[model samples]
Target chain A: MNAPAQPVLEVRNLSKSLGGKLILDDVSLTLNKGELKVLIGPSGGGKSTLLQCVHYLHRPDRGDVFLEGRSAAEMGRRNICAFRQEIGMIFQDFNLFDHLDAENNVAIALRKVKGLAKAAALARARAELDRVGLADKADLFPAQLSGGQKQRVSIARALAMDPKVMLLDEPTSALDPDLIGEVLNVVADLARGGMTMLMATHQIGFARRLTREIIFMENGRIIETGRPDDLLAPASESRAAAFCAKLTELLGH
Target chain B: MFDLAYYQTLWPRLFSGFWLSLSTIIPAALAGLAIGVVVGTVRGAMFPRFLVAPLNAYVSLFRGTALVVQLFVCYYGLPQLAMWLKPFFAARGLPELWRIFYLSPYAASVLIFALCSGAYHSEYIRGAILSIKKGQFAAARALGFTQAQTFWNIIVPQAARRAWPGCGNEIVYLIKYSSLAYIVTFKELTGTAMTLANSSFRYAETFFAAGLYYLFMTTLAAWIMRRLEKAYAVPGFGRG
Candidate 1:
């Protein structure tokens, strides 16, 4: 039989309100397996909130998230944790454990959560660190790593879990201008390798280059989504075009 | 008037008492610390729940009461309870293992001191555990670690590091409080010094010697704790 095809993640009619203010209003999206989608929007546009909702970090008020056709809402705690293991998330702040060195941080989930033996976990951790090009810095702590290096270690930490889908919420937003390219390069490489990725970023140029599709969000809703080349072109009527115009002007492009 | 002859007469007795005090204090503090760490981490991990509240209440109740009362309750009350049950009495009364092993007044004092200090130390440990960042907990959860795994692997190590200063201070206080062991007829340093003072009527000299010993011990403790703080200190986070 031929391999089956299915959407790896689906969010439908998702709504969330924080402190009586609606942050996400009936948003819906679908991500096919191995697809790279970029969500680009202005600040306070609910991109991060949407990512959190999909990650099940925040429960949507009125919506359903399905991962591999299974309802996220119906999954018990243990299953939900298992689900989270398959979805790797990279945060804007990196969020590396400060007390642990790079290798220990990567090994923690494997050993403590996955119940892998210490020696095996450490060996896997070293391999992941090596994949991130940080094998020599395994003994260094987060504070010791540079901005790009820290983000790489964060990527390594997430990748060590061997997640099926990766979520990046403005992963390069916290880095300096000089440091952004290095992080973006690593992400672009991941995308090229056909990892299922949903990234929310303000970097329109990088998003345009990396993602097969771009979602432009405004006022807690997705305004438009299409091929990045078509949506980002100057003549396109998509709201993404206007946003890209504004962004390009701001960047003096 | 300070007499060198009085000092000479008092020194041996005071030294003996001091040795008893050290023996009692060190073991008691270690036992108390172990109890506090375990109980406090469990309470902290169960926080915002009814279980944590009751444990917190238990800690407060013990801490709020005087150490003297707690000591009496353990030593005196437990025996009555022991005597009430025939099976318990048979097991614990005649030639009991505890009795055989802990025959000295010093051992009884250590047991009492451990229970008394354990209550207060638990609160310190709970506060330290609470001080860990919320992100740390979320990260642990995201990593698929169960509650127990997170507590042991992440929370306990961090809390232990943060709670070290408080624990060190508690140890010094424990040393000072071991003087209370003298009340139970333990001839620890303070008890020995008191007997010597009674005979020679040299209260000031005996107390001065005790004071010097405490100062020396506390200074040494402070130095060791400082070194530990430096060793475990998170780089870029500065001293705890």
Candidate 2:
């Protein structure tokens, strides 16, 4: 694949530690516009931390993230807020505002941050919810919805922002096995529509089918990066391939 | 024996005192809630130390003291403070500052109740705010909400819902405690009852009637609060 002249998102030597323990070390990756990359590894491999650091939720102790070629390290507090607005984040737990119903959850950021009027924001929210096939569930609170429905509402909430790029940290990890497909379908549709995305997920089969490249991380470092076909080939010696074989054996994928 | 004619005359005076009590309780409750919410949000959200220090002091001071003492300080102690500062005001050519210290019994009673209840209310609100899941805060921040917007729009509303029962208890406490207002010469229900009983030498009947009045007020206030709690409750949140 020919690389774009400038990447839409870039992580430069990002490092982070929690409670005096390093979680991510010297992690660097670039995401060109409209590219969807998957981060795969064992639990506690720093994939979630990498996504969070890029979003500045857990500020990196060292290193920088650039969006559209602007360094986050150089941005002021207000500019950081503006920068965060451009990059949407999805969480493993769905994290829908428990107090708000589905429609309000989708509309809140538009009304609050984007300064869209309530009527316009709600209209936009409805459209986004409709896209997720949850238009009928707009008035339901998070607790009232099933896990799959809740995840879709959260995705609608993130999509309503019209984000330049999206960081999804195990968007389907918290779902019941039978419920995972609905959430994955929405994510797959987003990829097909050319929304730039970086995702950390354990569903190797889904990653193999949809992602442009598969990134393997372990012990706070990226171990290997390659196309799914090349990395997961039966005869390959890559760690990702070995991990996938074990995973496939255990889950019969 | 209940004195029918005497009781008939007492009723009008008791009604007037009840009206005064009502006026005091309403504003004090509203103002106290406003102060509690603002103070609670600031403290819970972990604002800068300088601002938090004084608020911490305010909460500690109010909660630690007796309500009667706080009422006394507002009604009586301020005048003494004014006397001490009279020379300073005079030297500064602001003699009007003395008037600020000379609070009327009514004003002083409301002020004391609001401050004391506000302290308790803030504790409840702060606890509720802290109890919220951290993910919501992270999500709001990730969505580009400023700290203030996240606290007000996302955090505070949910906190308020969780804090509702606690705040409602404070309001009931406020209603019952409004009787103490008469201690400051405010001529509220208890004060009027005391005066009438002393003059008529009818302590038992008069005080019993007063007790009934208080019971009525507390019961009414409790019912109103329950209705409000029901109305304000969001679906799938808080106890039914």
Candidate 3:
């Protein structure tokens, strides 16, 4: 009935290497409108590199990425900036500009990239911060906030851009166990709200509860792909199930 | 013997010299800092190596040479070079080009001081810029900020904060080295003191008072720098 809504994001045969090491070999995925997909894999399996390549932070060696049906390779420099603005990225380090307070962190791209007026940008930024439940902490600097709070502020910063899709690269890996839940909660809410997203994370329980599609990668290739019920079942022989089991065993969760 | 009466008589001449020193130091310090920030930002950003290399050479040239030599070249050597190049200019119908090289002593002193201080300040700024984590630049780029916008708005501001103390030290040094202006007959504080001591033969008293003036200036500069560091500091940074 809906005509399949032209896949919101499509990555076809994206390949990359760093320092002569093959980091992503013929990696590919597609995300339809409002759908969330999880990338799970062992360390050095290219999950982070794949997200970066999707964002064009790392140029691919082969193949193409399309956003809303337009190939990123076809875009000029000016168009690339506009294209990047449409995709928000969250880093593992939670890179909120250290000099700015939480509110300015959210408002900066709105003012600089989008050219919003100071008063209007600040108002929108405050609303985003409130959405992340950080309204009272808006005045604080990154160093003054906890790990969870910094990640939330970063999430608010990205949300302020009104990105068409979000790329989160292990947004909670650097956080303490206690701080991880708060950042996960904000992310889970974004998922429920139907913001298209591709996340690289090791939190299997969280992934299982939220998304159906799982992509398992290893040594720069996708080793397995399926729903959590099929791949993550207790007795499944899939690599994804084994990897999730190993992660659970190590984390003792 | 302090010789209070003679020192009193000499006060007016010393005050005028002090005023000249203040005027020279103020403009030179401000110009040097501005140049450093501009040049250092270019060096720190991802500009082509060919472009950044010449600026690096400019820094090395100023830092490697003596300030006295630089002052002499700008004030004295330039006129000689201009005289030699006058024939070349004349062939091009530009006879007045030589006259541009004849800088007033005041101008020459300020030029040398500013350039020398700028070289030092630029090193501090470039180091600070490099010290900032790469993640900041990556984050700005991810937000769709152009390269120039990211450097000016994000990188430069943080680098300026980190480089403040080093730049402040250069100002203190400038206050003391300003005495060198006397070498080219600009007749700043030390020049005035030497003249008074020669006339009255009160060498010890005259020179001692001049020394006190420099000490007062350096101390004042230190206090001002401390206040500025406090004022511009972002809370929760550089803390344990």
Task: Give TM-scores for every candidate, taking all chains together and pairing residue i with residue i.
Answer: 0.83, 0.92, 0.95
Clashes of 3: 0
Spell out the clash pairs found in candidate 2.
Answer: none
lDDT of 2 by residue, A1-253 (tens): 9665559999999999999999999999999888999999999999999999999988899999999999999998898888899999999998889999999999999999999999999999999999999999999889899999999998898889989999999998898999999999999999999899999998999999998699999999999999999998988899999999988998897
- Give candidate 2 regions above 4 Å deviation: A1-6, A245-252, B87-99
Measured over all alpha carbons after superposition, the RMSD of each candidate to the real structure, in angstroms, is 4.9, 2.4, 2.0
- After superposing candidate 1 on the true structure, give the runs of residues whose Cα lies further than 4 Å from its correct spot: A1-6, A248-253, B5-11, B38-46, B52-116, B180-187, B219-234, B237-240
Per-residue alpha-carbon lDDT of model 3 for A65-128, expressed as tens digits? 9999999988888888888888999999999898899999999899999999999999999999
Where is the poorest 10-residue window by lDDT in model 2 chain B?
Answer: B231-240
lDDT digits (tens) for residues A35-59 of candidate 1: 8899998888999999888888888
- Whichever of 1 and 3 has more TM-score, that candidate is 3
Specify the highest-lDDT model's number. 2
The fnat scores of all predictions, in order, read 0.38, 0.72, 0.58
Top-TM-score candidate index? 3
